[model samples]
Target chain A: MSEKNHRVSRRQFLTYTLTGVGGFMAAGMLAPMVRMALDPALEAAGDSEFVSVGLSEDEVSEEPQRVDFSIELDDGWYSSEQSRSAWVLREGNEILALSPICTHLGCTVNWGTNEENPEEFFCPCHFGRFERDGTNIPGTPPTRPLDVYEVEVRDGMIYLGQINQRG
Target chain B: MRWNENDAKTYQSAKEYVDTAIIPLLPVAGGKEQEEAVRMGEFTSYLTDFLERQYTGRVYLLPPFTYLKEESTEDRLERLKTWTEHFKNQGFSHFLYVTSDSRWRQADARDLGELVWIPAFSLAEMDTNKRQQSIEQQAQQIIPLMTEKWS
Candidate 1:
């Protein structure tokens, strides 16, 4: 309405707009850091999903047998890892799924035939011997059993879920 | 409400209904990697289960025909013939073959008293949004024929 009143109102509007623009610019600069902080929380919400092992029940051996399988796991967009393990034995109708990871130290275990010892799974890292049931023997360096997967069979196929580490 | 809004009460009711009324109607088969396959195959099987459970008067649940990898056509034929003979002996009203493999040709469609060849839909063909629609369509087509033949 009045010239002085109009001038004062225009100055107030400009001040508010500049402050809002500055605030937006600051947020834009810090957005990456904010995302990085919240990344773990987002991952936890969707982490460790169940994956198909692609084995037919008929294919699994009745005795303590080694079945090697690999599954692709995604950590994020940047990387993918191939997780390979040997599932041991189908006890009756249920499966005893074991991870061939050395418990003494984290090392990949191999199934090899020792002429003296017959065929057994051996961890070369510390010379750990795991039985068909994945139990570490008394004299071996490994003090714990191999990891076990929660398994379920439905529609003539197997699915493996989270792994439980032995104490 | 929002487009993706989930009503807890409605969701719970639907889940309870599926668990109690629909799941028992399904023939649960077990195999290696079956749990995973079932998880993937649930969408298709749900339609079959729903129809068998809810429309028992008109629809019959058929036993699944197991597919084996064979080397010779003779072996395949023998297997198929044995399946048909088994069904007939089991007193099944009609027999149907569902397979995703297009290479399987029904040489003897009329061997059994009533046999229908239904192609199994691939996982890629039915996207997530269209899964239920595809199942419903398949059920409508397959169920009608079985009813017409056996009922």
Candidate 2:
């Protein structure tokens, strides 16, 4: 090829450099806005949202303890903080996090609340019972086992995540 | 269950389980400040919402029964009884009343419903966290009273 054809002119060089620099600067300003626009979609796609309930792995015992926690929720247009509670306990090497909502009728179940069912989770509404391991008693109103939350322990802090419904 | 079309559908299919109806009593006219009346309504709503969350399967949260506070106690009682009777006819076995009106305590409203009277306070003056904490504490106190009724 000819020398003039192979070489880049100053005008062409300045245009190429200016376009490259301007593209990067524009992207820098737009990156956050683009992310903000897609924030809800990104959040919906995230499946690993674990929330801490102020209960440590060391604190969890054989007996289930109710711990209250708050999680940020995004509902379409508005985002807000919501309060949630869970019954947590540690057994052998595995930590169990139980959802308090009863499967039969959705009334909250309290552990050791009933005199007759002292060792089990009792539902006062219809006298339903869940075993220590979150199994719904066979003859009880709950057709399925009590839902369990995904448990994660990080640096001794216990984090509870999405419920795994035992259907 | 809340008194909305979506909840009403759930309520129709599960009428046997959803037996309790939560009715709020509000005094719209007491010859008091307008802000005071608003506070009473606000507190009562918070209590009702808390109760519904804890007992959603069994409780139906109805709209408020607003009345003139200047009315005679007998007249209020009689009107409330009419409201209760309608709910009874509709198949509600339990009627829980959440109100900030002190007059309900003195009135012979036993047949009308189980009354939970919470005195009105200025929640607007408090910070967001403090107001939420205060409402929760107040609502928690009413839980045992309801459990007693359930038992």
Candidate 3:
């Protein structure tokens, strides 16, 4: 049964060793590129995770309040938590969550910052102003209205997702 | 806009829209103290970066102007005025000079720009929450000041 079966041939030994080492080297070279390609897909899976801004349904009122929250962002190999803020208000039966970022630039807009326009949102950067309904005032720097968030109310808690561009 | 190729291109194309220029003045010294100063400067730069991002289209954030702490104030002011003049010629109407060094406060720079001197906050000693809180507080104070200038 025997000596020939128990001992490996030179050709077989060389083929097995070379293939094993070659496969390992190939994987080592391709692993990072594969990860780079798949990273966006992996990150997209977590994109739907809604962050709570710690505001309850009862707390929301007609007056806009600044609500701050943090979100986990994955940029290729780097992962970091970024802080975000939104001006949230309750209008009758609906909730309105508007991004404070000005449409003209990226500056944060304040509610009633301008004493003359107490009902509007005002941008400090360039005097950009928006109406009480988050509409950009005509003749202002901002051409578009403030971005609104997708809101979900669960168990009296408010959850915010991706920002949706509004008119 | 930052002093990078992409932002520079934007600045060039939209010079009319981009009217504000932010210059961060960082002071460096010799020896171990230089390391601490540099670290503080880095934190200051970070704050400027945040400010620039907040008002991206209208504000152009230039890279830090690093100078020796021992350098003459008259000479520095002369050079800074020239720099601001260059920026003004390029269509920038508003100039903001942000620094942690109190020395800049003593310098005559009315022709150069508005000097915003913030007390240096110790980033190394604070936790993330405290650091964020400090940054937010500083930002809150700065926003109104910048807005007043615009008005």
Off by over 4 Å in 1: A1-8, A45-47, A58-62, A73-83, A91-94, A105-127, A150-154, A161-164, B1-151
After aligning candidate 2 to the native by TM-score, how far in Å is the CA of B117 from where it should be? 1.1
Model 3 per-residue lDDT tens digits across residues A19-127: 9999999999999999999999987857677888888989999988889888887789999878788999877788999999989867778899788899889987778
Q: What are the DockQ scores of the candidates, in order?
A: 0.01, 0.59, 0.53
Per-candidate TM equals 0.40, 0.80, 0.81
Q: Which regions of candidate 3 deviate over 4 angstroms?
A: A1-43
lDDT of 1 by residue, B24-84 (tens): 1111336764553344345435555534532332223444444333334456556667766
Query: lDDT of model 1 at residue A21?
Result: 100
Q: DockQ winner among the candidates? A: 2
Evaluated against the true structure, the overall lDDT of model 3 is 0.84
Candidate 1, residue A138: the lDDT equals: 74
> Candidate 3 residues B26-136, lDDT tens each?
999979778768776967886887788778878899878878888899988888888898889888888988888888888988767678888786788876557777887
Ordering by TM-score: 3, 2, 1
Q: What's the TM-score of chain B for every model shown?
A: 0.49, 0.91, 0.91
Steric clash pairs (candidate 3): none
TM-score quality measure for candidate 2: 0.80
Predicted structure with the largest TM-score when compared to the true one: 3
